[model samples]
Target chain A: MKLVIAVVQDKDSNRLLNALVEKDFRATKLASTGGFLKAGNTTFLIGVEDAKIPHLLEIIKQNCESRDQLVAPVSPLGGSADSYVPYPVEVQVGGATVFVLPVEQFVQY
Target chain B: MKLVIAVVQDKDSNRLLNALVEKDFRATKLASTGGFLKAGNTTFLIGVEDAKIPHLLEIIKQNCESRDQLVAPVSPLGGSADSYVPYPVEVQVGGATVFVLPVEQFVQY
Candidate 1:
Protein backbone atom coordinates (compact mmCIF):
# COMPACT_ATOMS: atom_id res chain seq x y z
CA MET A 1 0.00 0.00 0.00
CA LYS A 2 1.12 3.56 -0.62
CA LEU A 3 0.04 7.00 0.52
CA VAL A 4 -0.46 9.58 -2.25
CA ILE A 5 -0.37 13.20 -1.14
CA ALA A 6 -1.24 16.04 -3.56
CA VAL A 7 -1.67 19.77 -3.06
CA VAL A 8 -3.94 21.57 -5.52
CA GLN A 9 -5.44 24.97 -6.00
CA ASP A 10 -8.88 25.70 -4.61
CA LYS A 11 -10.45 26.26 -8.01
CA ASP A 12 -9.94 22.77 -9.43
CA SER A 13 -10.67 20.84 -6.24
CA ASN A 14 -14.36 19.96 -6.73
CA ARG A 15 -13.93 18.52 -10.18
CA LEU A 16 -10.86 16.61 -9.06
CA LEU A 17 -12.80 15.19 -6.10
CA ASN A 18 -15.86 14.19 -8.15
CA ALA A 19 -13.58 12.40 -10.56
CA LEU A 20 -11.93 10.52 -7.72
CA VAL A 21 -15.31 9.50 -6.38
CA GLU A 22 -16.24 8.18 -9.78
CA LYS A 23 -13.13 6.02 -9.68
CA ASP A 24 -14.03 4.67 -6.24
CA PHE A 25 -10.85 6.03 -4.68
CA ARG A 26 -10.91 7.48 -1.17
CA ALA A 27 -8.65 10.32 0.03
CA THR A 28 -8.23 12.67 2.97
CA LYS A 29 -8.17 16.43 2.51
CA LEU A 30 -6.12 18.73 4.69
CA ALA A 31 -6.11 22.52 4.83
CA SER A 32 -2.67 24.08 4.42
CA THR A 33 -1.34 27.51 3.52
CA GLY A 34 1.29 28.28 0.93
CA GLY A 35 4.66 29.75 1.80
CA PHE A 36 5.01 31.84 -1.36
CA LEU A 37 1.78 33.62 -2.24
CA LYS A 38 0.05 32.70 1.01
CA ALA A 39 -3.05 31.73 -0.94
CA GLY A 40 -5.63 29.10 0.02
CA ASN A 41 -5.05 25.58 -1.29
CA THR A 42 -6.33 22.02 -0.80
CA THR A 43 -4.24 18.96 0.02
CA PHE A 44 -5.37 15.42 -0.73
CA LEU A 45 -4.17 12.22 0.88
CA ILE A 46 -4.90 8.95 -0.90
CA GLY A 47 -4.04 5.38 -0.10
CA VAL A 48 -3.68 3.11 -3.09
CA GLU A 49 -1.80 0.05 -4.28
CA ASP A 50 1.66 0.65 -5.62
CA ALA A 51 0.69 -0.75 -8.99
CA LYS A 52 -2.02 1.85 -9.30
CA ILE A 53 0.28 4.82 -8.74
CA PRO A 54 0.68 5.65 -12.42
CA HIS A 55 -3.03 5.44 -13.07
CA LEU A 56 -3.85 7.62 -10.08
CA LEU A 57 -1.20 10.11 -11.14
CA GLU A 58 -2.81 10.38 -14.54
CA ILE A 59 -6.08 11.31 -12.91
CA ILE A 60 -4.38 14.02 -10.87
CA LYS A 61 -2.55 15.39 -13.88
CA GLN A 62 -5.75 15.66 -15.86
CA ASN A 63 -7.43 17.50 -13.02
CA CYS A 64 -4.68 19.93 -12.03
CA GLU A 65 -4.27 22.01 -15.16
CA SER A 66 -2.61 25.39 -14.82
CA ARG A 67 -4.31 28.67 -15.62
CA ASP A 68 -4.00 32.41 -15.27
CA GLN A 69 -5.18 34.25 -12.17
CA LEU A 70 -5.33 37.96 -11.49
CA VAL A 71 -3.70 38.88 -8.20
CA ALA A 72 -3.41 42.35 -6.76
CA PRO A 73 -0.71 43.51 -4.41
CA VAL A 74 -1.48 43.34 -0.69
CA SER A 75 -2.81 46.57 0.72
CA PRO A 76 -5.17 47.68 3.49
CA LEU A 77 -7.80 48.81 1.00
CA GLY A 78 -8.74 47.02 -2.20
CA GLY A 79 -5.50 47.57 -4.09
CA SER A 80 -7.46 50.82 -4.35
CA ALA A 81 -4.34 52.49 -2.97
CA ASP A 82 -1.74 54.03 -5.28
CA SER A 83 -0.26 50.54 -5.75
CA TYR A 84 -3.41 48.90 -7.07
CA VAL A 85 -2.76 47.08 -10.31
CA PRO A 86 -4.66 44.01 -11.48
CA TYR A 87 -1.65 42.06 -12.65
CA PRO A 88 -2.33 38.88 -14.56
CA VAL A 89 -0.05 36.13 -13.48
CA GLU A 90 0.24 32.81 -15.24
CA VAL A 91 0.41 30.80 -12.06
CA GLN A 92 1.34 27.17 -12.47
CA VAL A 93 -1.02 26.20 -9.70
CA GLY A 94 -1.40 22.47 -9.91
CA GLY A 95 -0.37 19.26 -8.22
CA ALA A 96 2.90 20.02 -6.46
CA THR A 97 3.92 16.42 -5.78
CA VAL A 98 2.50 12.95 -5.25
CA PHE A 99 4.16 11.61 -2.10
CA VAL A 100 3.83 7.86 -2.28
CA LEU A 101 4.74 6.37 1.08
CA PRO A 102 4.73 2.69 1.84
CA VAL A 103 2.03 1.80 4.31
CA GLU A 104 2.87 -0.79 6.93
CA GLN A 105 -0.73 -1.78 7.51
CA PHE A 106 -4.09 -1.29 5.89
CA VAL A 107 -7.49 -2.21 7.31
CA GLN A 108 -11.07 -1.06 6.99
CA TYR A 109 -14.02 -1.88 9.21
CA MET B 1 2.54 33.33 16.96
CA LYS B 2 0.14 30.52 16.08
CA LEU B 3 -0.58 28.19 13.19
CA VAL B 4 -4.32 27.71 12.78
CA ILE B 5 -5.25 24.73 10.64
CA ALA B 6 -8.81 24.15 9.54
CA VAL B 7 -10.32 21.23 7.63
CA VAL B 8 -13.61 21.98 5.99
CA GLN B 9 -15.93 20.23 3.57
CA ASP B 10 -15.17 20.89 -0.10
CA LYS B 11 -18.62 22.27 -0.72
CA ASP B 12 -18.11 25.28 1.49
CA SER B 13 -14.62 26.17 0.32
CA ASN B 14 -15.27 28.81 -2.34
CA ARG B 15 -17.49 30.85 -0.09
CA LEU B 16 -14.99 30.58 2.70
CA LEU B 17 -12.14 31.71 0.47
CA ASN B 18 -14.12 34.70 -0.68
CA ALA B 19 -14.92 35.68 2.86
CA LEU B 20 -11.31 35.39 3.88
CA VAL B 21 -10.26 37.52 0.95
CA GLU B 22 -12.82 40.08 2.00
CA LYS B 23 -11.25 40.11 5.42
CA ASP B 24 -7.81 40.66 3.83
CA PHE B 25 -6.45 37.39 5.16
CA ARG B 26 -4.63 34.75 3.13
CA ALA B 27 -4.79 31.01 3.77
CA THR B 28 -3.33 27.87 2.22
CA LYS B 29 -5.59 25.07 1.05
CA LEU B 30 -4.65 21.43 0.88
CA ALA B 31 -6.47 18.53 -0.72
CA SER B 32 -6.78 15.44 1.42
CA THR B 33 -8.87 12.31 1.74
CA GLY B 34 -10.82 11.30 4.80
CA GLY B 35 -10.44 8.28 7.08
CA PHE B 36 -14.16 7.71 7.52
CA LEU B 37 -15.98 7.96 4.18
CA LYS B 38 -12.91 8.60 2.04
CA ALA B 39 -14.41 11.77 0.71
CA GLY B 40 -12.74 14.96 -0.51
CA ASN B 41 -12.07 17.93 1.76
CA THR B 42 -10.28 21.28 1.73
CA THR B 43 -7.83 22.29 4.44
CA PHE B 44 -6.86 25.86 5.27
CA LEU B 45 -3.69 26.98 7.04
CA ILE B 46 -3.54 30.43 8.51
CA GLY B 47 -0.89 32.10 10.61
CA VAL B 48 -2.25 34.70 12.94
CA GLU B 49 -1.62 36.44 16.23
CA ASP B 50 -3.11 34.99 19.40
CA ALA B 51 -5.45 37.91 19.76
CA LYS B 52 -6.79 37.33 16.21
CA ILE B 53 -7.35 33.61 16.77
CA PRO B 54 -10.86 33.96 18.16
CA HIS B 55 -11.88 36.22 15.31
CA LEU B 56 -10.54 33.82 12.70
CA LEU B 57 -12.25 30.88 14.40
CA GLU B 58 -15.56 32.68 14.19
CA ILE B 59 -15.23 32.92 10.39
CA ILE B 60 -14.54 29.21 10.14
CA LYS B 61 -17.42 28.33 12.43
CA GLN B 62 -19.85 30.39 10.43
CA ASN B 63 -18.76 28.77 7.17
CA CYS B 64 -18.10 25.17 8.21
CA GLU B 65 -21.67 24.36 9.10
CA SER B 66 -22.77 20.73 9.44
CA ARG B 67 -24.40 19.24 6.38
CA ASP B 68 -25.59 15.94 4.93
CA GLN B 69 -23.55 14.11 2.31
CA LEU B 70 -24.45 10.87 0.57
CA VAL B 71 -21.68 8.24 0.50
CA ALA B 72 -21.76 4.74 -0.83
CA PRO B 73 -19.74 1.73 0.19
CA VAL B 74 -16.52 1.31 -1.78
CA SER B 75 -16.72 -1.38 -4.40
CA PRO B 76 -15.06 -2.18 -7.70
CA LEU B 77 -18.37 -1.28 -9.22
CA GLY B 78 -20.88 1.24 -8.06
CA GLY B 79 -23.14 0.47 -5.09
CA SER B 80 -25.58 -0.15 -7.96
CA ALA B 81 -24.28 -3.73 -7.96
CA ASP B 82 -26.76 -4.72 -5.29
CA SER B 83 -27.34 -2.11 -2.55
CA TYR B 84 -27.77 1.65 -2.91
CA VAL B 85 -29.13 3.89 -0.25
CA PRO B 86 -28.87 7.68 -0.15
CA TYR B 87 -28.00 7.92 3.50
CA PRO B 88 -27.77 11.24 5.27
CA VAL B 89 -24.81 11.82 7.58
CA GLU B 90 -24.64 14.89 9.78
CA VAL B 91 -20.88 15.06 9.46
CA GLN B 92 -19.13 17.58 11.71
CA VAL B 93 -16.73 18.61 8.96
CA GLY B 94 -15.11 21.59 10.50
CA GLY B 95 -11.82 22.72 11.96
CA ALA B 96 -10.32 19.76 13.76
CA THR B 97 -7.47 21.53 15.57
CA VAL B 98 -5.39 24.69 15.55
CA PHE B 99 -1.67 24.23 16.06
CA VAL B 100 -0.09 27.40 17.34
CA LEU B 101 3.65 27.21 16.90
CA PRO B 102 6.03 29.90 18.04
CA VAL B 103 8.07 31.05 15.12
CA GLU B 104 11.70 31.63 15.94
CA GLN B 105 12.14 33.72 12.82
CA PHE B 106 9.65 35.80 10.88
CA VAL B 107 10.66 37.61 7.71
CA GLN B 108 8.99 38.94 4.60
CA TYR B 109 10.78 40.05 1.50
Candidate 2:
Protein backbone atom coordinates (compact mmCIF):
# COMPACT_ATOMS: atom_id res chain seq x y z
CA MET A 1 0.00 0.00 0.00
CA LYS A 2 1.02 3.58 -0.56
CA LEU A 3 0.31 6.58 1.61
CA VAL A 4 -1.02 9.41 -0.54
CA ILE A 5 -0.96 12.85 0.98
CA ALA A 6 -2.92 15.46 -0.96
CA VAL A 7 -3.01 19.03 0.28
CA VAL A 8 -5.93 20.94 -1.20
CA GLN A 9 -7.74 24.18 -0.57
CA ASP A 10 -10.67 24.26 1.85
CA LYS A 11 -13.16 25.02 -0.92
CA ASP A 12 -12.46 21.64 -2.47
CA SER A 13 -12.02 19.34 0.55
CA ASN A 14 -15.64 18.53 1.32
CA ARG A 15 -16.46 17.66 -2.26
CA LEU A 16 -13.25 15.68 -2.61
CA LEU A 17 -13.95 13.76 0.58
CA ASN A 18 -17.43 12.96 -0.62
CA ALA A 19 -16.13 11.75 -3.96
CA LEU A 20 -13.55 9.52 -2.27
CA VAL A 21 -16.17 8.08 0.04
CA GLU A 22 -18.48 7.39 -2.85
CA LYS A 23 -15.76 5.31 -4.46
CA ASP A 24 -15.02 3.46 -1.18
CA PHE A 25 -11.76 5.30 -0.83
CA ARG A 26 -11.34 5.98 2.85
CA ALA A 27 -9.07 8.79 4.00
CA THR A 28 -8.26 10.98 6.97
CA LYS A 29 -8.54 14.77 6.85
CA LEU A 30 -6.42 17.43 8.49
CA ALA A 31 -7.06 21.18 8.58
CA SER A 32 -4.09 23.09 7.26
CA THR A 33 -3.11 26.43 5.81
CA GLY A 34 -0.77 27.52 3.08
CA GLY A 35 2.73 28.69 3.93
CA PHE A 36 2.78 31.62 1.52
CA LEU A 37 -0.87 32.65 1.47
CA LYS A 38 -1.72 31.51 4.99
CA ALA A 39 -5.04 30.53 3.49
CA GLY A 40 -7.04 27.61 4.90
CA ASN A 41 -6.62 24.27 3.20
CA THR A 42 -7.19 20.58 3.82
CA THR A 43 -4.85 17.62 3.64
CA PHE A 44 -5.95 14.07 3.09
CA LEU A 45 -4.07 10.98 4.23
CA ILE A 46 -5.25 8.16 2.00
CA GLY A 47 -4.08 4.57 2.29
CA VAL A 48 -4.57 2.58 -0.85
CA GLU A 49 -3.23 -0.33 -2.80
CA ASP A 50 -0.50 0.58 -5.21
CA ALA A 51 -2.55 -0.35 -8.27
CA LYS A 52 -5.26 2.17 -7.43
CA ILE A 53 -3.05 5.27 -7.32
CA PRO A 54 -3.95 6.50 -10.80
CA HIS A 55 -7.66 6.32 -10.02
CA LEU A 56 -7.11 8.17 -6.76
CA LEU A 57 -5.16 10.89 -8.50
CA GLU A 58 -7.88 11.27 -11.07
CA ILE A 59 -10.46 11.69 -8.36
CA ILE A 60 -8.32 14.26 -6.56
CA LYS A 61 -7.61 16.17 -9.74
CA GLN A 62 -11.29 16.40 -10.49
CA ASN A 63 -12.24 17.72 -7.08
CA CYS A 64 -9.30 19.88 -6.10
CA GLU A 65 -9.29 23.01 -8.25
CA SER A 66 -7.03 26.03 -8.65
CA ARG A 67 -8.10 29.68 -8.84
CA ASP A 68 -6.68 33.15 -8.60
CA GLN A 69 -6.60 35.13 -5.36
CA LEU A 70 -5.80 38.80 -4.90
CA VAL A 71 -3.15 39.71 -2.38
CA ALA A 72 -0.61 42.41 -1.67
CA PRO A 73 2.86 41.70 -2.87
CA VAL A 74 5.31 40.87 -0.11
CA SER A 75 8.10 43.02 -1.43
CA PRO A 76 6.30 46.04 -2.75
CA LEU A 77 8.06 48.67 -4.92
CA GLY A 78 11.20 46.65 -5.50
CA GLY A 79 12.17 46.20 -1.84
CA SER A 80 11.67 49.84 -0.98
CA ALA A 81 10.43 50.04 2.61
CA ASP A 82 9.48 53.67 2.47
CA SER A 83 7.32 55.23 -0.37
CA TYR A 84 5.59 52.12 -1.62
CA VAL A 85 2.17 51.47 -3.11
CA PRO A 86 0.83 47.98 -2.31
CA TYR A 87 -0.96 46.78 -5.38
CA PRO A 88 -3.26 43.74 -5.11
CA VAL A 89 -1.45 41.24 -7.27
CA GLU A 90 -3.31 38.20 -8.46
CA VAL A 91 -1.82 34.87 -7.43
CA GLN A 92 -2.98 31.38 -8.24
CA VAL A 93 -3.98 29.19 -5.30
CA GLY A 94 -6.11 26.07 -4.64
CA GLY A 95 -3.97 23.57 -6.52
CA ALA A 96 -3.10 20.32 -4.75
CA THR A 97 0.29 19.59 -3.22
CA VAL A 98 0.56 15.84 -3.36
CA PHE A 99 3.13 13.45 -1.91
CA VAL A 100 3.10 9.71 -2.45
CA LEU A 101 5.13 7.74 0.06
CA PRO A 102 5.83 4.02 0.22
CA VAL A 103 4.19 2.55 3.25
CA GLU A 104 6.39 0.27 5.35
CA GLN A 105 3.38 -1.22 7.11
CA PHE A 106 -0.37 -0.62 7.43
CA VAL A 107 -2.36 -1.92 10.36
CA GLN A 108 -6.10 -1.57 10.86
CA TYR A 109 -7.42 -2.32 14.32
CA MET B 1 13.45 21.56 6.00
CA LYS B 2 11.52 18.40 6.78
CA LEU B 3 7.85 17.75 6.30
CA VAL B 4 6.38 16.35 9.47
CA ILE B 5 2.99 14.74 9.13
CA ALA B 6 1.23 14.15 12.40
CA VAL B 7 -2.13 12.37 12.53
CA VAL B 8 -3.77 13.37 15.77
CA GLN B 9 -7.24 13.12 17.27
CA ASP B 10 -9.74 15.90 16.73
CA LYS B 11 -9.99 16.60 20.42
CA ASP B 12 -6.35 17.60 20.69
CA SER B 13 -5.79 19.34 17.36
CA ASN B 14 -6.68 22.85 18.39
CA ARG B 15 -4.46 22.79 21.43
CA LEU B 16 -1.56 21.37 19.50
CA LEU B 17 -1.87 23.94 16.73
CA ASN B 18 -2.03 26.66 19.33
CA ALA B 19 1.08 25.36 20.97
CA LEU B 20 2.93 25.15 17.70
CA VAL B 21 1.94 28.64 16.68
CA GLU B 22 2.96 29.90 20.11
CA LYS B 23 6.40 28.53 19.42
CA ASP B 24 6.47 30.15 15.95
CA PHE B 25 6.11 26.85 14.19
CA ARG B 26 3.77 26.88 11.23
CA ALA B 27 1.72 23.88 10.09
CA THR B 28 -1.20 23.02 7.89
CA LYS B 29 -4.16 21.12 9.34
CA LEU B 30 -6.21 18.46 7.58
CA ALA B 31 -9.50 17.07 8.77
CA SER B 32 -9.28 13.29 8.79
CA THR B 33 -10.99 10.30 10.35
CA GLY B 34 -9.41 7.24 11.91
CA GLY B 35 -9.20 3.99 9.98
CA PHE B 36 -10.45 1.47 12.53
CA LEU B 37 -13.00 3.52 14.43
CA LYS B 38 -13.93 5.89 11.58
CA ALA B 39 -13.83 8.69 14.12
CA GLY B 40 -12.91 12.28 13.39
CA ASN B 41 -9.26 13.23 13.66
CA THR B 42 -6.90 15.92 12.47
CA THR B 43 -3.64 15.64 10.56
CA PHE B 44 -1.01 18.33 10.69
CA LEU B 45 1.48 19.05 7.91
CA ILE B 46 4.25 20.90 9.65
CA GLY B 47 7.26 22.40 7.89
CA VAL B 48 10.21 22.59 10.22
CA GLU B 49 13.96 22.72 10.17
CA ASP B 50 15.67 19.34 10.55
CA ALA B 51 17.19 20.39 13.84
CA LYS B 52 13.75 21.05 15.39
CA ILE B 53 12.14 17.63 14.84
CA PRO B 54 12.57 16.50 18.42
CA HIS B 55 11.03 19.69 19.68
CA LEU B 56 8.12 19.38 17.24
CA LEU B 57 7.58 15.78 18.37
CA GLU B 58 7.60 16.87 21.97
CA ILE B 59 4.94 19.44 21.24
CA ILE B 60 2.81 16.91 19.41
CA LYS B 61 3.23 14.30 22.15
CA GLN B 62 2.21 16.76 24.78
CA ASN B 63 -0.88 18.01 22.95
CA CYS B 64 -2.16 15.03 21.01
CA GLU B 65 -3.74 12.74 23.58
CA SER B 66 -4.62 9.05 23.48
CA ARG B 67 -7.70 7.49 25.06
CA ASP B 68 -9.87 4.42 24.89
CA GLN B 69 -13.04 4.29 22.82
CA LEU B 70 -15.79 1.68 22.73
CA VAL B 71 -16.37 0.11 19.33
CA ALA B 72 -18.04 -2.95 17.92
CA PRO B 73 -15.71 -5.76 17.02
CA VAL B 74 -15.30 -6.35 13.30
CA SER B 75 -15.90 -10.08 13.61
CA PRO B 76 -18.43 -10.51 16.35
CA LEU B 77 -18.48 -14.26 16.21
CA GLY B 78 -15.98 -16.78 14.95
CA GLY B 79 -17.12 -18.24 11.59
CA SER B 80 -20.78 -17.67 12.42
CA ALA B 81 -22.70 -14.90 10.71
CA ASP B 82 -26.24 -15.58 11.90
CA SER B 83 -25.59 -16.22 15.59
CA TYR B 84 -23.32 -13.18 15.98
CA VAL B 85 -23.87 -10.93 18.98
CA PRO B 86 -22.09 -7.64 18.67
CA TYR B 87 -20.30 -6.47 21.76
CA PRO B 88 -18.61 -3.11 22.24
CA VAL B 89 -14.91 -3.37 22.94
CA GLU B 90 -12.62 -0.69 24.26
CA VAL B 91 -9.97 0.36 21.76
CA GLN B 92 -7.30 3.00 22.04
CA VAL B 93 -7.51 6.14 19.92
CA GLY B 94 -6.24 9.76 19.76
CA GLY B 95 -2.49 9.36 19.44
CA ALA B 96 -0.27 10.95 16.83
CA THR B 97 0.76 8.93 13.77
CA VAL B 98 3.81 10.89 12.81
CA PHE B 99 5.86 10.62 9.63
CA VAL B 100 8.97 12.70 9.03
CA LEU B 101 9.91 13.01 5.40
CA PRO B 102 13.00 14.55 3.86
CA VAL B 103 12.03 17.47 1.66
CA GLU B 104 13.60 17.57 -1.74
CA GLN B 105 12.80 21.21 -2.26
CA PHE B 106 11.21 24.02 -0.27
CA VAL B 107 9.64 27.17 -1.68
CA GLN B 108 7.42 29.98 -0.46
CA TYR B 109 5.81 32.56 -2.72
Candidate 1: which stretches are off by over 4 Å?
A36-38, A69-91, B1-109
Instruction: Specify the poorest-scoring 10-residue window by lDDT in model 2 chain B.
Output: B30-39
Model 1, span A46-75: residue lDDT tens? 767788888898888899766555554454
lDDT, model 1, position A74: 53
lDDT of 1 at B69: 49
How do the candidates score on chain B by TM-score? 0.65, 0.72
C-alpha lDDT of all candidate models, in order: 0.63, 0.76
TM-score for candidate 2: 0.48
DockQ values per model = 0.13, 0.15
